[model samples]
Target: MNTLLAEPGTLTTSPIRTQQPTGPRIEVTGRMHDRFDEILTPEALAFLADLHQRFAGRRHDRLADRMRRRFEIGNGRDPKFRDDTASIRSDATWRVAGAGPGLEDRRVEITGPTDRKMTINALNSGAKVWLADQEDATSPTWANVLGGQISLFDAIRRQIDFTSPEGKAYTLTTGDMPTIVMRPRGWHLVEKHLTFIDSSGAAMAASGSLTDFGLYFFHNAQALIDSGRGPYFYLAKLESSEEARLWDDVFSFSEQHAGIAHGTIRATVLIETLPAAFEMEEILYELRDHCAGLNAGRWDYIFSIIKNYRGRGARFVLPDRSDVTMTVPFMRAYTELLVKTCHKRGAHAIGGMSAFIPNRRDPEVTARAIEKVSADKKREAGDGFDGTWVAHPDLIDAARAEFDAILGDRPNQVDRQRDDVEVTAAQLLDVHVGRAVTDAGLRDNVSIGVRYLESWLRGIGAAAIDNLMEDAATAEISRSQIWQWIHQDVRTDDGAPITRDRVERILSDLLSTVERFDGDRFDDAADVFREVALKEEFPTFLTVGAYSRFLVDLA
Candidate 1:
C-alpha cells in the first residue's frame, strides 16, 4: 500500500473548483434566502445572484436601527438590565486566589424530551426548564409535528399526563416538572408544515424564514402572555451577538405590544454558528436581563465551521474527522469564557447536549456509557455549567441524577448575582482573529482560527488548541494551523487505528500543558479526558464529533 495518498484537501467531490460567496451576504427585507436560492447551487455565481436578489434594494441599516431602538440599547447596553460592573476582566488573567468550595454544591436543571407523555411529565417535573425541541430530535414529517403542538397545549392546560397520542397511559404530576420551553424550527421547511396544517397537504402560510419564524413565534407568545402563560423561547443557531441582540429587541417589542413588562420575556441562545463564538459576551449582555443561559451548540457549530470555511477546498487538511479535539485549548478557552461570563452576570452557563446514545441492546455498553456521561456531566457542573441537554430518554436520568447529586438542597447556590464582565473589541480580536500563523501551517492552524475567529462569531468564545491559553496573556500566534501541517505526515503514518485512547492522549497532553499554568483547574479538567477515553467502545461518538459529551460530561 502507498504510504502517502491524496491530501484530505485534494479529495474533491466535484471536478471543478466551485465558486463560493464571501461574508456580509445580503438579505432581502421580509424575504427568505432559501426562496431566492431554491434554484441555484452553492457555487459562486448562484451566491452572487442570490446576494443581488436578497440585498440589492433592502434596508439592512433600517432594520438594525429599528432593532436597536426596539431593544432600547442606550449607549451600548440593554435598557432593561443594569450592568453589575462597568468593566469586564481580561481572559484567564485573574489569579485563583484560593481554592474555592468543590463546585458539586452547584446545580444544573435540564428539561428532557421523553415520549410525548414522558416529555410532558418531565416538563412539570422539578427540572428548572424544559425545551420542547422541534428540530434535530424529531422526524421531519407529520406525526411529530402534531405531537409537538399537542404537547405544548397539554402542558399549558396542565393536562400532559394521561395517555400519549398513541394511547399508552402516561402523565405529568404538577410539582415534579420544570418550566416548559419551546424550541421550534427556524425559518425552515418545518415552519410551513407547523403554522398552517394544509387540508390538501399544502401549507397555507408562506415558507418561513428566520425573520418570519420570529414573527410567528412572537405572535403566538403574545397570545400566550395575554392569556397569562409565560413568554419564553430558546433561540437556536445564533450566528452573532448582533443576531442574539436582534432577538432581544424582538422579544422586548413583542412584550410591549402585548401589554407585558419589557423584561418579562426570556431567551436561551444556542451558539450554533461559527460567528457567534467570538461575540458570546456581547450576545449574553444583549440578552442578559432575560437570558436563561447559553448553550454550547456543537453539531451545528461544527457543520458551520466546515461549510463556511473548509468547504472551499475538497480535501481537509486535518487527518480523519476523529483526529479533531474538542478538549483542545481553543474549546477550553471558549468554555472558560462562557463560565466566567455567566458567573460575572449571574446567568447560568448551560453545557451543550451529550451525543452519546446508550445502546439499549447491550446492558454493559449502556452501563459504561451512563457512567462515563455521568462523570462528564459532573465535571461540567463542577466547572460551573448549570445544566445540559440530552437526546435520548435513557440518558436523561443519568444527566439529571448527576445534576441533582451535584446540587443537593442549595437554593441560591448558583452565583447569579454579579456584575457584567467587560471585554473590549481588541481583547476579543486578540483571542481570535488577531492570532497570527504562517501559510505552511494553514491546515492545523485552521482549528485555531475556527475556535478564535469562528467561535467568537458564534458567541461561544475561542475553542481551540491547548497551548493557546497556557499563559495569562493571549497569544497573537495560532499553533494549531502550523501544528496541523507539520503533523500531517504523522497523522497518516501507517496502520494506526484512530481510537479514542489516541485522541484522548493527544488532547490530554495538550490540555495538560495549557492547564498546568492554572494549577487545580487543569487537574480538574483531566476527568473530562478520562471520560472521552472510555467512549472508544462507541463508534458513533467518533463520527459525529460527540460535542455534546464535551459539555454534558461536566461532572
Candidate 2:
C-alpha cells in the first residue's frame, strides 16, 4: 500500500491520537465530557473546521437544489434518469475499486449504534461487516457522538470490551472480526455542538457528515490501511449524483491531505431516496474509483417516496408500513434495478435490514419472525444480492445461511449480472397498494411512531417494539404513512376515513395505557409525532426538528 500519513504515528491499545490539522478556530457549544479529548482533539477539530470551510457553500447549494427538485416533483414531475449523464451509465468498461481487504465476503452484515456493548457484541456476532452507525441508529447527543468515535477507535485496535452494570462480561471473539464500515450522518444534518466561523466572520454549524468523516479519517485512515483494512463508509440519504460527486471530492481531498493513496477509501451509497433510485448507475459512475456498491435502504426509500408525493394526490399514498414489503411491485423494481446497476458496474449490491428483533419471552413468536427473516434473505440471495443486514445478533446465522447456500465458496455474486432487469420511471412510481388498509394498520402506525419517538427523545435511536427493530427510518415511514393516509382521504377496511382527529385520539389512548419508564418522554414524543404527522407541510426528517428542539444542550 505504501501510504504515508501527514504525521506518522503508531496505534497502541490506548486511545491516544497523534496527528494535526491547521485551520480556523471552531466554537464547540456542547458540554465537554471526560475522555472526549481523544476523539475531539484540537487537530481533529481543526481538520473538521477546515473541511467545513472548504465545502460549506457547496453543501448549501446542494440543499437548495434539493428543495428546487422536490418542488418540481411536487408540481407534477416524475423523476427520470438524467439525459446529461447517460454517457457515464452507458460506458461499459468502467468499474469501481471493488471489495477492499476484510470486505470480500459480506454475506452477513450486522448494523447498530456504536455504543460500547454493541461494539463488542457485533464484533463477536460473526457477521462479515459491522455497520458502526453514527447516523439514524444513533441519537447525536454530545456523549453519543464522541462515544461512538471512541468505541470505534478502540474496537479497530481490539482494545474494546464491555462489562454490564450487573456484572455481565462481553468481549470480541477470537479469530476474524467483521470489517468496520462507518455510516456518518447524511448530507442534510449538522453537528450543532461544533461551530466554525466562516470568511465573513459569521459562525456556522459544522456539517455532521463532514465532522464524522473528517475526524474518523484524520485519526484512523493510516492505521486502518496499515492493518489490512481501508477506511470504508456507507453513505446514507444521498439524493443525487451531484451529492455523490461532492462526496467523491471529499474522499479525494481527504486522501491527499492525509497523505494516503488515492482510492484507498471505499463507500457504498444508500439508494434510499426517490431521486437517488433514478440515478443509481450515475451515482456508481461518479464514485467509480471509490464506490464499492449500493444498498437498498428500503424503509427510507419508502419514506422519501411518500414525502415527495405527499400532496400529489392518491397515487403516492403508501398503504400501511406493514403492507409495503420488498416483494411489492414498486419496491421490487427498485431493488432489482439496484442489483442490475451494481453488478454491471462491478459493485456489490447489499440488501436492506431484516428488521425483526428476537422475542426471547415467546419462543413461538421468535421462531415465526426468524422464519420470515430467512425468507426475506433467501429472496435477496436468490435475486443476486451479495449480502443483507440483520438488526439482532440472533438472526446473523440465519441471514448468513441463506447467502451461504447461494454463494457457496464465492466471495460475492457481483458476477451475476441481472441483464434482463429493466426499470422505467413509471415502474418506479407504481406505489399503489390496491388492497384495503386496515384499522389495525392505522393504529399500529401511531403506536410505533410515538413509541419510537419516545425512545429517540430519551437519547435512544434504535428500539425494539413488537419484536421489530424500529430506527429512524422505520419511524419516518410510519409517521409519513399516517400523514399520507389522512391527507389523501384514505379509508380503512371498515370504511372509516383516516383523519387527523382519529389518529390523535389513538395517540391519546395509547399514552393513557402505556407504561412509562423513569425517564420516558411520551408527552414530547406525542407532540413531535403530532407536529410531523398531522402538519400540512412535510418535514425532511423527524430528527432535524426534534434534535434542535429537544436534544441540543440537553439538561
Candidate 3:
C-alpha cells in the first residue's frame, strides 16, 4: 500500500494501484469487498474524477461563503431575503421540469439507508417514493457506501431478493414499487476511500456528494430512463441558489454524457437550512430545468436556526428538543411559506418527516406512533402539502389514509396555490421563547446525543432510540440545543441552570444507565458529544467534526 500526504488538515488515503484503464488518475484506498468493483468501475470513477476537476473549486467556494455567512449572522446580521434575487422570485413564466413518470402521485415516501434489506423493504413499502438516503441516514463507512450502491443496482434490476443467515427470505412485494429518489451526501463531506489526483500531482479526498451522485447516475441513469422513471434525486443540505445552480450544471452535464435528453433528471430540493428558507424561489429557479419540487426538512431546519442564531441572546435560544414541534410560531411560518412558494411556482410542496417509528413488541408504542403519524399527515394534507414522509414502513398506511382523504382522485394539489398565505420576515424570525425547558429535557438531549453518536460510529446512521427514529439531523439538534442552553444560561422548569459541569455530570451518569447494544462505543461517543455540545465555540455540524475524528481515523 502507498499513501502520500497532500495538504495540511486534509485526509490522505492509502491506495494500492489496481487494474488501471480510465480517463484520469484515481485510486481506491478502501479494501475491495464482494462485487464492489461493479459499482466502482473504471469508467464510472473517471467520470467522477472529471467532475471533481471541473467543479471542486466551486464547491469549496460555496462552503467558504457558508462559513462567512454564519460568522456574519452570529454578529447580528439578520438572515432575510436578499434584494439581489428579486427578479427570479417575481418571474412566473418559468416552471420546473415537474414530476416525471412514476413520480406523479407521491402521497407517501419512506426514508432509510440503502442497505440490501432496506432497499428491499423500501421498494415493497407501499409508498410512492423511497428516499434512498446516502447522507444523514447512512454511516458513510467504506463497506456501507459500496454495499448501498450494489443493493440499489440489484434492486433496480429486479434481482435483489435474497435469504438471510437465519433462513428468512425477503422479496419485493408484487405491486407498484416506490420510485427511487436517491439523496447524496452534502457537499461538505469528503469520501476518503477514493482519492482524486489531478494533473498537478495533488491528491485530495473525493467529494462525497459527487461520489454518491456520480456512481449512481453513471450506472443507473440510462437504466432508469429505459424504465420511464428517469433519474430522480432529493438534494439535501443546500444553503443557497448558487449551490442549486451547481447541481443543475452537474445534472445537465450528466444527462448529455449519458446520452439522455436534457431535463431527463428531476430533483427535489430539501429547504432545510435557515439560509435556504430565505432563498427558496431562487433555488427553484436555478434548478428549474431539473427541479421536481421542494421538501420541508423540519429537523435540519430547526438545527439550522439553532446553529446560525446560537449567540444572538435568549430570544433566539430554543426549548427542549421534544418541545420544538411543528406547531410553533416560527415553524408554522416555515411550512406556510414553503407550501405557498412551491404552489405559486407550479412545484410540489412536500411535508417534513414524522419520526415516530413503530415498536411491534409494545402495542401502546405502536398505537402512539399511529396516532401521531396520522395527525401529522392529516395536518400536512389539510395544509395543501402534496405528500409527507414516514420513517417506518408500518406507518405508511396511516399516512397514506390522510392523503387519500384530501387528495381523493387527484395526483397532487399543486393547483391549490396558497395565495392567501403571506409570510413576513418578522414571522419567520419570530421566536416564541417559552418556559418549557426542564431537567428531564436536558438529560434527554444528553442521553440521545451520546447514544446516537455511539451507533453512528458503529456504522449505523438511523437508530431507534426511545421508540423514535433518530438520524444525524436529530442528533445535531440534540447537541446544538445543549450548546445553546449552556451559552444562553437557560434554566430548566425546576430552576436548574444549564452549565458545562451540569451537562457533563448528566452525560457521565447516562453512560452507565443507558441501554447497551452491540458495538457500543460510549466512551468515544461521550468524548465527541462533549466536544461539540460543551465546547464554547459551536460546531457547525456534528457529523463534520465526528467524521474527521472517528470515521476516517488513521488507526
Candidate 4:
C-alpha cells in the first residue's frame, strides 16, 4: 500500500503502488514520462480501481450478451426492437437533459486525435464544437494514451502551445474556442498498460473506457465546471440501451464522487451500431438525465452491419465501401429514424462525418470536395439534424453554411419533429440496394485496408488516403467489406469471383506498393489484414488484436 508521486518535470518509470486492503492493487505498467504523475496520481488510480471493481463484471456480462445476440442473428433470428423496452420507447413525455453551457450551438464539430498540433488547430477552427477523439482517431500506444491526456489538460486551461521541429510556433486564439467533447474508447477494447491485481494475485487489464474517462474526469471535471463548462462526452460504439444505462450509472457515480451536481455531465451517444439503431428511443430514455443527443455514425454503422451479417447469405452482402453513401435507402432510413426518435425525445439529432480533407493544389478537386460536403450537410440540415461532424478544419465553412441556412438564428433544429419518417426494421436491414460490386472497388478496399493498418501500426490512427481523412472506421469498413465479399463469393463486374487466392494476390500487390513508404509495418499490417479478412471466423475488431501485439510493445 505504498503510494509514491513523482516530482514535476521527472518521469516515474516504477509502477504506482496502491494500499487499500479491499480494493484492487492498481499498477501503471506503462513507462511514465514528464507530467505523467499529474494525471496518474495515486488518488486517481484508487478512484479508477474502485470503478473497475464495481462495474467490470457488469461490463463483461454485457459483452457476453452482445455475443449471444450476434449468434442468434447468425442463426437466422431477425433482430427487432426489444419487446421489453417497448414501453420505454412509447413513453414520449420523458426527454434527455437539453444542451448545457458550451454545447448549446454545435452546428459544426471538428473531430481528430488530441495530438498537440491537432489540439491547437481544432480549437482554433471556426466550428462550434471540437470532438477531441480518443477512440478511432488515436492509436492506443501508451505514449498516445498518456500524452493525449496531458494535451487535453493543458488545452482546457488555455496553456497549450506547440513548436515544430522547424521552429514554427502554434498557439490558440483569444476568443471563440470550440467547445470540447471527449469520446472514449469502445467497450471491447482494453488498456493493457494499466493492470488491476486482486487479493488472490489475479491480474486483469483495465477497461479503456474507464481508463480514458476516469483520468479525464478526475483531472479536469472540476476545472471545466469552474470555467462555466461542465464535463461533456461523446459515447461511441454502444450496441444497446443497457450499455447506455451503464454509462448513466457511471456518470451519476462520478458526479457524486466529484461533489458535482447529479446531472451536471452531458453525453451525446453515437448510434453507430446496427442494433443501436433499433433502440435509439430506449437509449435516450436510459440516459435521459445525462443525454444531450444522438449522432449518426455512418462509417461505423456500416461496419457494424457487415460484422453482424457477414455470413447471412447474399441478402446482407454490401457493395463497395464507396458505394454506401448517406443517401442510400437503408442509411437514409437510419438517419431519418434517428432524427425522429431524438426529436421525439427532445434530444439533438447530430449527423454523420464528412471525411473529405481539402486538397488546395487542385482547384477542380477542391471544388468537387466542397460540392460533395455542401450537399451532404444540406441534406442533413433538411432532414432536421442539429449538427454535423467534419474531419478537417477546411470543411467547417461548408458545413456551417448549410446548417446556418437551415437554423438561421436558432441554436438547433431539435424542434423539427420528423413525424413523416417511418423506418421499419426491414428497411434498416436493407443492404443489397446500393451500387454494384466492382473489381476496382475490391482493389481499392485492399489497398486502403493495408495502408491504413500500416499507419495504425506505426502509431498513427487517422491517415489521409486519397484526400480523405481515414480512421479506424475506414479500415473497419474496408476490411469488413473484403471479408463479406469473400464469404459470399461475390463476383465483381469484371466477371471474376472473389476468392481468398485473389484477395491474397491483391494484398501482395498492395503490400509491394506500400512497402516503399511503410517500412517494417507493412509486413505486420499484411499479417493482421490476412488474419481479419481471410479467416473463416471474422475478428470482432482489428484493433483489439493489433493493440495487444504491436502497440503494447511500445511500452
- In terms of lDDT, which candidate is strongest? 3
lDDT of 1 by residue, 109-152 (tens): 44333236647556644455566665444322233433455556
TM-score of 4: 0.96
Backbone collisions counted per model: 64, 0, 0, 1
TM-score of 2: 0.95
- What global local distance difference test value does model 1 have? 0.43
Q: Which 10 residues in a row give candidate 4 its minimum summed lDDT?
A: 2-11
Angstrom error of the Cα, residue 124, model 3: value is 1.0
* Consecutive 10-residue window with the lowest summed lDDT within model 1: 1-10
Off by over 4 Å in 2: 1-23
Candidate 3 residue lDDT tens string, 1-555: 644323212323345434332333556777777997788775777688778877888899999999999999999998888899988888778887788888888899999999888889999988899999999999998888888999988988888986888998999875667899999999889998888777676778889999999999999988887877888999999999999999999999888888888999999999999999999999999999898899999999999999999899999988888888888989999999999988888889999897888999999999999999999999999999999999999999999999999999999999998888998888888878574788998998998999999999999999999999999999999999999998888999888899999998898789878777776899999999989999877878888878877777331
lDDT of 2 by residue, 314-337 (tens): 867777778888988999999999
Q: lDDT of candidate 2? A: 0.87
Pairs with backbone N, CA or C atoms under 3 Å apart (clashes), candidate 4: 1-19
Ranking of models by TM-score:
4, 3, 2, 1
Against the reference, the lDDT scores of all candidates come to 0.43, 0.87, 0.88, 0.87
> Candidate 1 vs candidate 4: which has greater TM-score?
4
Candidate 1 regions exceeding 4 Å error are 1-118, 124-126, 140-147, 161-167, 187-229, 311-325, 359-361, 404-408, 411-555
